[model samples]
Target: MDSMKNKIKLLAVTHHDKKNINPIRPEASQIIGLHRSGEVDVLVLCNPGSILIPYFEKEGIEVLTDPLEKKLSISTVLNIRKLIKNRDVDVLHLFNNIACSNGATAAIGTRCKVIAYRGQTGNVSRWDPSCYLVMLHPRLNKIICVAKAVENDLRKYLWGDKSRATTVYKGHDQSWYQNESADLSDLPIHDDSFKISLVANLRPRKGLHVLMDALALMPEGINIDVLLVGADSNNEKIKEMIQRSTIPKRVHAMGYREDAPEVAAASDVIILPTTKREGLCRAVLEANSYGVPAIVSDTGGNAELVENGISGIVVEPGNPKELADAIVQLYKDRAQCKEFGVNAKRRAVTKFNVEQGVDATIKIYKELTK
Candidate 1:
């Protein structure tokens, strides 16, 4: 235990700007809090031109910009050398692919420990494969997989050092669920009708189209509104898909929102109809914490978070009719929804709270340093 007093300095590396990025805010806050509380000394490394560099600096955390971006250099080796010399960072904690590549390089020459976080089940495309990443950094002391499915994928695809891989279920802000009562009118979809929400990036993997198909196939007229929340319209594929869908006026496309808990509280059901490949989604936990049961795809870690016919209903991935039937079934049975919602809250409190996640991370750090 005395070794824990070494007071190791940590460098959190990510692709997005820590200060202004909404999705990464929870992770940034938790890591910063861990540092502020004397568990670790922390620094942040991100793209040079990020908007939130000053924000991280204001929080008393040192910020490092990718020198390559600033100098307009293409040589990664020189850039990494510059980073090591400038930051004098002791350990590298990577979040994104770019961060892992650069930070891993810096760690090699220096006496810095490398810990990479693989938050998703797989890469967005072949260009960003997580398994390939594990192959790139053999000395990565730990690889934090958000789901068991992700861990399995890493084992099969990358065949990474199994001894180093650890599954830490994504955590959520518990205090957001504790109070419970809040205004629903300001929410994206707040009609007196039953509201269902699917909080995910407007991407194919999210399977929003399948949800829309399911909603359209419902036999009886159900008074319900579906709220879809996310950003990243770079592809505009989702926008095109939504425009072509023949669903009624009940389905709402609400863009990126920072107040996710409030949005979850306003909705009656949380739906995650992923096509395939997902980490333990934080949105489902957020919704479940607010006593909103989820209708999630059974793939990846969705089943791990949601107990079938217990906390939430699990439908086959990409099955629109099955998803629709499950939604309609839950809608018809208010008693079941309430029961599942209560159980969901209990599960979230027990397994997915931020404190528990931070504690688990701290324990891992202690074990490593020991």
Candidate 2:
């Protein structure tokens, strides 16, 4: 075992911009935890004035801003190389595909071990040269998948090595779920209406349209209301769909609520009927932490987080009928919902807590550094 005195000097890189007030990704929280625990001397490399900068700085962690481009730019590579050389970075932790490629290139001649964090289950196009460069890079020593499902997907690729890659579920700060006095007074909800919440970015892959389709197919006399809480990605398409739908009055498009935990608390059941697989569904985890059972599609890490018919129901992806059936079933049986909620909360607290994630990640860092 490495001595605590010889902490690893880690450089965590992310391509995410500072668009929102708070850090949206799990990497930020993990870095903050690592720094505070004295497990790693952490420095974050991100875009200029990135939303992450303020958050990292508030925690007294150092941040470096660089224009990390998606394409293979010489300047980006050289800058990263310089940072690695000057800082004596023991490990380069990359959070995105582009950053992984650039960091791998930069670490070519250095002793720094490259660790790529794969958080999405989307398969890389075989024709994309950059994907090959990033995934199969000789400099990359470890691939940290956010879920077992993601790791399985990576193994299908030519460059993915089962021996080198491992799953590490992203953890959440339990504090985010500790909103006992959460008030959803702002949302439109009647005392008699059953609320179903879908908290994700309003995008095609998130399967908002599929969820809406399920709602349209919902059996009559269900008396259900849906709260769509996320940033609008497809303009007013969702709104327009709601307006023209059979239950327009029952659906509320609450765009990008910062109080997501509170929103989950207010809802009876949470759902994520995504068509595409995710690295892991953080929304589902958050809802589970708040003791809200979810109905997620059997895609990506959704099934991993939600034990089908146990913690929550797992319906087939892109199937409106199945989604609708699951929703209706859960709605009809309140006891099952309560039981699932209890199990979900137990799993979230016991297995998916931020402390557990940090400990796993720190162990990986120690293994690499040693």
Candidate 3:
């Protein structure tokens, strides 16, 4: 083991809905980006349900799938073990808790280091029992939480051992925003009307209800059209919420789109009314990258991104009145919006680009190897 090459081969495995895989999370993109840049060798093992196989294969990264049913499958575990042994993988990075639990168990004989990545660190009740259970494994060296808020929550609710934790902020495409020649006509909305866009899934955690309530309370003089971009996942509650809303005409529930920056560009102000405990949200950075001001709720990393009244507005999570007030304030003051937008973009360019994130992650990996 001491004489082994320093070159790292990382295995990122996720079990999400197939259609939702590509358009949804930034994990796959991050891994592929790193692999393409020759930073590391990534072998993606997604749920058999995901179509990410072709995408990963296209990028020249080895892709594998497991027929792991909802319940634990012994075959799946064995197959993963075989893959790890064949590739001589240096680290096994699990994107979700289920995979982490399985990977921990699989690494028992091989003594391979395991790292788990958590996107959100909510309350104890929100945590998967598998994550807590995986901590029992000695091979599991670290858990990467996307934000400091999540790291705090993990120490408070789940794991008290802070030594095994690390925080890594998700990066965005900074150059896309800086490239003035990039075209945005491909985005769904190109109209000149006052546009307010929400780039989140139509899930309860995202606080779409709060956003709707705020829209209802918006000032009478403000004429704003909203584009709520996200997948429904057949959630009846969200469906009913969208159906029951009176602002259907004003709000276009255009489902998920890969070109999120394009949608951000078509908007005047981006809104993220998340009530759930989020880690570092990429949407905020992406929104800020396009020089679009945001009115985010005071949840997770929202406060960290929005510089109060300077770059953007941060209101109480799930507070419709406060959200409405902030939105109206920005609406009435276009100059303030422009000022905040400029600052937001500057912040994104300087701090949250993909290259910076990759550099930080590689540094961590190198340190871990040493």
Which 10 consecutive positions of candidate 2 have the poorest summed lDDT? Answer: 17-26
Candidate 3 lDDT, 1-370, residue by residue in tens: 4422446777777777756442344666667777876657778888877766767788888777885453345776787788889888777887776787677667768845678776775645424554454543456778777777776676565444666777777766655455342243444443555788887575688988888888777665456777777745366765556555455556666676766666777678999899977767777777788889899988887777788898999999989899989988887889999999999988877766666667767766666666
Using lDDT as the yardstick, the better of models 1 and 2 is: 2
| Separate clash counts for every candidate | 0, 1, 0
Model 3 vs truth, CA RMSD: 4.2
Cα lDDT of model 2 by residue, 1-370, tens digit:
6664488899898887547543465677888989988869998888785778878999999898888866576888898899999988998999887788888988898999899988778757667666767776667889999899888887777454566778887877677677763465675666777888887565688887788788888888778878878736355777676764478878877777777767877788998888886868877888898889999998888889998889999999999899989988988899999999999999898888778778888898889888
TM-score of each: 0.81, 0.90, 0.82
Model 3 accuracy (lDDT, Cα): 0.72
Give the TM-score comparing model 2 with the true structure, all chains together: 0.90
Top TM-score hit: 2
Query: How high is the CA lDDT of each candidate model?
Result: 0.72, 0.81, 0.72
Collision pairs in model 2: 18-51
Arrange candidates by lDDT, highest first: which order? Answer: 2, 3, 1
Per-residue lDDT for 289 in model 2?
84
